[model samples]
Target: MTRSNTARRTVAALLTAGVSAVLMTAAPAHADSNDSCHPSGAMPRVGVFGNEFAPAPSDPLVRAQGWVDAGLTCSPMGSFGGYRTDAGGYAAMAWRLTESMEPSELLSTGSVTPLAGRDDLAPGDGLLNPAGFGHAVVFDHWADDAHTSYLGYEFTAAGVQHRTIPYPYFAGQGDFRPVRAAR
Candidate 1:
């Protein structure tokens, strides 16, 4: 064979081998089995809405403050209000606007604090704190008989658009129901 022809074949073989190596090393792109909020074969499409708090502007400010980069998953079975995080990602900040609102005691201690801005607490006061505000909040509203709603908020925090999903209603609270996956 001609020298040029031999060179061309060697180059082609090397290219093919390189391509195969890359394909083998690549991890499979599969739906997160660990994610409870995401249904099987469902890709997570994050959408941002308005803030949960108004007048005082809690939602906008929270976005502006920016939370840590974290992954969250919520499932329907077991505890209706249960939440999970991405191990380590972004930190959260909490802002308790009401005197009766305490997030740490409620989320961690499993104790229920009075809803902020209720008749008992001042109009603008709701348990607002920065402690867990920067962390990603995920709620699994898809479980049957689960009365939790998942809300995703997008706001500019430190000049960046941050996305947050909060479960404000759970277990006989606001009307939160799961959505069926699109066929």
Candidate 2:
């Protein structure tokens, strides 16, 4: 059979079993530490609130594209953002879908759809910054049982970095929404 067909069948079988079982437990076996995710000699600067590897690009679409490309190149899981090159991840994909429509027509469409709630979040989900100007990252999973905190993988100005942010933190930062990848 073709590789694509084989891949689809494998995915179908896994989904038939349960996708959460796969996402919840598929993180790299390595411990959660800066050393584990980031390469040597590339220590992200410690910050008062959040770590800043570098200044993110002013344009949200540019930033999103950079994040997905960087993740594809270096994520230990083999696919960092779980995004394909053609679609250009969430922001770019969303932009593509909404471009033809009038600004006020307001149709939000893309390779992803918003999650109903945080309870529905899973690893590999796309986290959007917000409606107009926004950024995106790959959800890594909650870091605590209370579900108050979660881990995320995003490409920063410095490079690809794993981020530990609280659940409410995203909202406070105007990134209150999370979306699941369509594929």
Candidate 3:
């Protein structure tokens, strides 16, 4: 083959390889699992309040089940206030309520109770609850409106729990919008 034709084929092959690499590394936003919930490294601990309660020590099996369901790892460590750490050694907490987690079951825990109205939740309205699957989650809804709302979750690292609340935004109106849904 001519040198020019050979070079052109080489370039085409390189481009195809590059595209494949990108696709392989790009994971979906809501793949579900501990990998999706907690990135590499360590998770952090957090605190909880109100009627919220942490998973009991004897309930490791229950907590593990919850974590698996939510795509997370449950490791019980200790308790502070009302929050408790899971076997994965991260401080976690959860609240119990019966509600619909339609659209995206991956993000929704089927226990989030909608506040009376937008006025019910303020910018720093923090909520502590057990997210099934032995995962304890803390969220603060910083914004709420007719269209949507925004909140943040507290993650753990090493043995410390840090609060990482995302900026205010919207929630799913009809179907499950996991991107917009709060913890």
Candidate 4:
């Protein structure tokens, strides 16, 4: 299989592996340090009071695409109980689907595998910002054959967006790194 397909498989596993843990024990909500960053509201058909485990749709990609396809606005950007409980920021559509992953813990103590570069990105793989409080997104697919542009899904101040990210953005900027849930 291609690296992209391998990435997708890893992400699928990453996204599903934690559901078992979620069933075993309900993770406590440890609010983020900055209360000012807490969620201000909830997204439609998503979560309650910005609770990631609060019966929202479980698939990150599905949730993101649904919001974009329906043009639904996202909840305001806010930090919540830990990264897993975060339901209003860039990680909103994904947190519950994977283990709690703080930016600082990525690829080390966190439950993900890193890639060499963007070319390995696949649908469902995470485009994570290694710089603590930056952007997080899911790679959808390459938008162009030259690999200059790609489709990505994420939640932003405007709401859930599935748009083309072209050169000079993360693809060209190299600020974000490609990652997948560890096998």
Off by over 4 Å in 2: 1-107, 168-171
Q: Lowest-lDDT window of 10 residues in candidate 3? A: 169-178
Instruction: Give the best candidate by lDDT.
Output: 4
lDDT of 4: 0.52
lDDT of 2 by residue, 75-116 (tens): 222222232221122333323332211111122544467788
TM-score of each: 0.20, 0.42, 0.26, 0.52
Candidate 2 residue-wise lDDT at 3: 100
Comparing candidate 3 with candidate 4, which one achieves the higher lDDT? Answer: 4
Candidate 3 structure quality by residue, lDDT tens digits, 1-183: 999999999999999999998974464332222322343444343442332344544332343334334533223333333333342222223232112111122234433444444345543223332233323333344444452534433333222232333222112211221221234
How large an RMSD does model 4 have?
Answer: 18.2
Model 1 residue runs over 4 Å out of place are 1-61, 68-112, 116-148, 153-183
Q: What lDDT score belongs to each candidate, Candidate 1 first?
A: 0.27, 0.46, 0.35, 0.52
| Candidate 4 lDDT, 1-183, residue by residue in tens | 999999999998987888866753452222122321324332222223444452356565765565556544433333333223232244534544333334435556555678777778777777666544445666778888887877876554444556776631443323666777553
TM-score of model number 3: 0.26
Q: Which segments of candidate 3 are over 4 A away from where they belong? A: 1-77, 81-83, 86-112, 115-120, 123-137, 140-160, 167-183
Per-model clash counts, in order, read 27, 0, 33, 3
